[model samples]
Target: MNSAFLFGLLGWLDLFGIAVFATSGALAAARKGQTLVTFAFFALVTGVGGGTVRDLLIGAPVFWVQDSRVPILCLAIALIIWVTPVRIWRAGAVDWFDAMGLAAYSVFGAAKAMQLGIDPVPAAIMGIITACVGGVIRDLLAGEPSIIIRPELYVTAGALSAFSFVALMQTGMDGIVAAAIAFAAGFALRALAIVKGLALPVYRGAAEDE
Candidate 1:
């Protein structure tokens, strides 16, 4: 795909991912009995943290700052979650939304890196950052353990997807096609991990733990 089309597609996908992240973050804040202000803070961080980091590292303008739409989108999602009946909010849908956000951000980050002429390794690393950092920030704000520190295969899924995209790009596949494949791979892996309790190996030794 052309660069313009790729950028536009990435923008839309990223926005949807941000909405998912914001909604999930809002739910977490609600679970903590936080006020609406807290919910908005969590939502904004979860929605924009990863993209901000990615843009800074790549020397692009911070995304949400340039486009007012991103923050507006996040706020709208937060409002929706905040105003929804508590019973509906408690129905365990947030986890699914979080997974989708992870998949979307992973694809967007890897694609952006490739567009910026970065090497594949860094591109893949960017993808992982994009997928996880927002959640990390939200968890910190909510006083929960960050997902990256968990034994679960969260970051690994992002890495796998990003590397797959990079590899496909190296072989001359179109950016859009590669992004779609990467998103599918990451989402599938994450869903399977959640269902089957898959986790990355932790060190059995004390020294390793230290």
Candidate 2:
């Protein structure tokens, strides 16, 4: 509930999220027959990309660089997946990992911003960046479209989680409690979106290009 305990919890969540993201990214590289170098590249980028961006924007030290554990954890996760059977990298596992990463990063971003004395709105936006930038970078490196640009409810889920965290903070809820609720909400929404093919409605302008 206190700031110290809240931060420790956030650190654990961030590590767990990075591991899951790395595993998913490594599995994707393996499926594409990428070499070990490529696997490590994907794992590192998918694990630390979002957090790096968020920290840079906020003028905080780059997290993984500050704590070697993050990158090491990511590599370990990738190695484990690489040695495992291919079936473990099935679509369902990917979805679950993605959901978990989204939730964890959203909470991490919001909590970090709050600690740094950022306003609620910007903090919420930071949360979205923390949740989506890793996936965007990973997809771009994999020669796939960035998920944030797609209508797959990815950013929406992050926004919802971030806003929830901010609202709870404004209401004087403890940081850890707010973070846990925000993570669960985002994860549930993302899982449902994946299952039901849910998406935000797109605007259609009269212009041909639009």
Candidate 3:
């Protein structure tokens, strides 16, 4: 794939991931009966927090700061939620969006890190950060238990996506093809978690320690 075209596709995927996450944030604010301003705040932070961290760690400009449209996209999501009735928000809609974001952002982040000359293992870690940190920020700000701690396969799903992409790329697969397979792998895991309550088993302390 053309390098420029690959970056363009990755950028679009990142934006789509941001939109899904931002909408989830806005919906969270709506659930809490927060003001529209709060919705915007939550949306922006939740949409960009992970990528911001990723960029900072990589010594790159913060993504939302560099792109004028990123914050605007966050604001748009908040506005959409503000104008819509909660009744219109279907059950499990947020989970579906989250799953999509988890898949898309993981692959996008890994790809970008690889482009920036990051080592493959760390690049995959960056992908997980891009996929989950925003949601963590949202959860903390909203005073909810962080989803990261939940006994679900959330981060594992993201890791699988990121790892899949990196592994495929190492095998000389096309970036776009690798990304598609990675995203599907992650989203499938999350879908099973949501639909079937699949989760990682909680660790139990040693019997003597307990």
User: Per-candidate RMSD vs. true structure?
Assistant: 1.9, 1.7, 1.3
lDDT of 1 by residue, 10-36 (tens): 888888889898888888888888888
Quote the lDDT for 83 in model 3. Answer: 98
Identify the runs in model 2 with alpha carbons over 4 angstroms from their true place.
Answer: 206-210
State the lDDT of candidate 2 residue by residue for 92-192, as single tens digits.
67567877898888878887887888888998899889888888888888887777877778888888888998898899887778888998999889988
Give the worst 10-residue stretch by lDDT in candidate 1: 88-97
Worst 10 residues of 2 by lDDT: 87-96
lDDT of 1 at 70: 84
**TM values, all candidates:** 0.93, 0.94, 0.96
**Superposition TM-score, candidate 2 onto the true structure:** 0.94
- Candidate order by TM-score, decreasing, is 3, 2, 1
As a whole number from 0 to 100, the lDDT of residue 110 in candidate 1 is: 82
Which segments of candidate 1 are over 4 A away from where they belong?
A: 207-210
Candidate 3, residues 3-118: lDDT per residue as tens digits?
96467789899999999999988988888899999999999998999999999888878989989999999999999999997899987777788889899999988888888889
> Which stretches in model 3 have alpha-carbon errors above 4 Å?
206-208
Clashes of 2: 0
